[model samples]
Target: MLPLAAGPPFGPEHTMILEQAATALTLARLTSSPAWDRRAHSSVLLDLLHWRYRSRTEARLRAEALGLPTTGHRLVPVVVDHPGAPSADGVALTDHLASELLSSGVKALVGDLAEGRSGLLLALARASAWQPVVERIARELRAAFGPDVVVAVGPGVTELGQVTRSFREAEEVADAIGPASRDRPFHVASDIGLPELLYSLRDDVRLQKYVEQQLGRLVQHDARHGSDLLDTLRAYLDAAGNKSIAAKHVGLSRQAFYQRLHTIERLLGTDLESGAQRTQLHVAVTALESLGPPAELG
Candidate 1:
């Protein structure tokens, strides 16, 4: 089995960790006997991941209280979230996630965040291959919760004092990634991309107007004529302005594809091959997708 992280702790416990985690989730869900239990059945994770403790002794005490095995390793903070305040079902889901991680011998603690989010503190004994571990857990999370659940994995910290910073990193990743499907359910702080940036800008009205302006012409063309120039433009841009590749993707010869590209350029009044125009279209397309299908394309 791969080590939880890349460094020292590797082997023996790797394969069964995910299975154990799944079992833990199942057991936790079964024990969800109460509804709307806001008492934070597990809040030590909040203290561990939010604020710094005055001393190592204090941190250790809190970790122990949360059933985290923090003696020989520094814990990695992982945060998962869904939209809106968590209902009883959501809480049960979070509890199951925490339990599964702990059961997998992950030396972890689980707690509910103020909103509809959950925090986890995991002890990975100096292992450097933690990315795979996070990815594995993420797959399980997506499978269990569908596409809406997002997992943000923080960098590993060797000291208790640094854990809150790691948690903060996880928080940023979770926010940037937003609600996701299983194909891309989790991300790290370092992986923030244009899509994530667009997601964060979803509330800005100006952003919406900007998207409408950039691609509105083609959208309207498609609506009016049953044409697919908008989709063709999307493919062209996505292909990085490579004519041959985009042509092949759109199932057209180079000549036909060039004609379509020319038509799109005339319609949009922008050079498809120009980097500036491509960037604008890219952002607009990303924004449109993020905002959901427009009520009126134009």
Candidate 2:
């Protein structure tokens, strides 16, 4: 046997090294204080990670660690710094945050809140490039919160801190659209026309009447059947055409679900099976959902 060491089997040398390493890490964490605990207890770090990575692990872990008791239901939280547009300091903060996110591995940025408005925070995702993710995030948020809140998702920015304006614009335009604020979940500068039209429509009792007359039936159908059908379709499309699973979501027999699809197709006069038709129906459904319940078609 080797001669007796100064400490236990590992010896003083190994123990000293391990202790030193722990001490160094602890010091680093302390320096990084308020310790967002990217690995342990998430906070703003979750936003950073979403910018960097496309998941909510830090937030989930932090929430769980705190005994928050969530449904394990994670939202792809799109964070828009409030006052949507960045101030000089805000810009710097966003840059640092963006750098932190890039270092973490985030792929897309979503927001269209106007500058000097609330910042937009989106869930980390890599589906359908930018638009689909924005739409999905918005739709899901609405389904959960029910039109009370409006979320704006900007386009994807390969570079850091570029989406600051997108988030700002999204919110400004959202407020511009007012009553029709939710029309598009993710709004890019290019989508300004829609918001302009939305502003006009807000005051147009006749147009609102037409929308109700034309789409109200479908809206009622969705509410009676499930307010989540739009999300269901989003998921269904995401899964690449699987009706059985979609049927299961709404708790319908495959046959009954098929019937529902037929009803949607008849009312919308569009085919859910085809990509183009699906796209149109998707836009229509989204618009209807955003508009909320219709009043009489007066």
Pick the TM-score winner: 1
Q: Where does model 1 exceed 4 Å of error?
A: 1-42, 47-60, 69-71, 82-91, 127-129, 178-186, 253-256, 294-298
Once fitted onto the true fold, the runs of candidate 2 whose alpha carbons sit more than 4 angstroms away are 1-214, 220-241, 294-298
Error of 2 at 275 (Å): 2.4
lDDT of 2: 0.46
Question: For candidate 1, lDDT tens digit of each residue in 1-298?
Answer: 9667667765545434554456446445644553322233345566666574455656655455435666668677888886653343554667667656757877666667757787877777684567777788878776766667888888887777788888888887777774432257577766787888788777789988998899888888788888888778888889988989988998999998899889888988898778998988988988887777654544
Global lDDT of each candidate: 0.72, 0.46
Clash numbers, per candidate: 8, 41
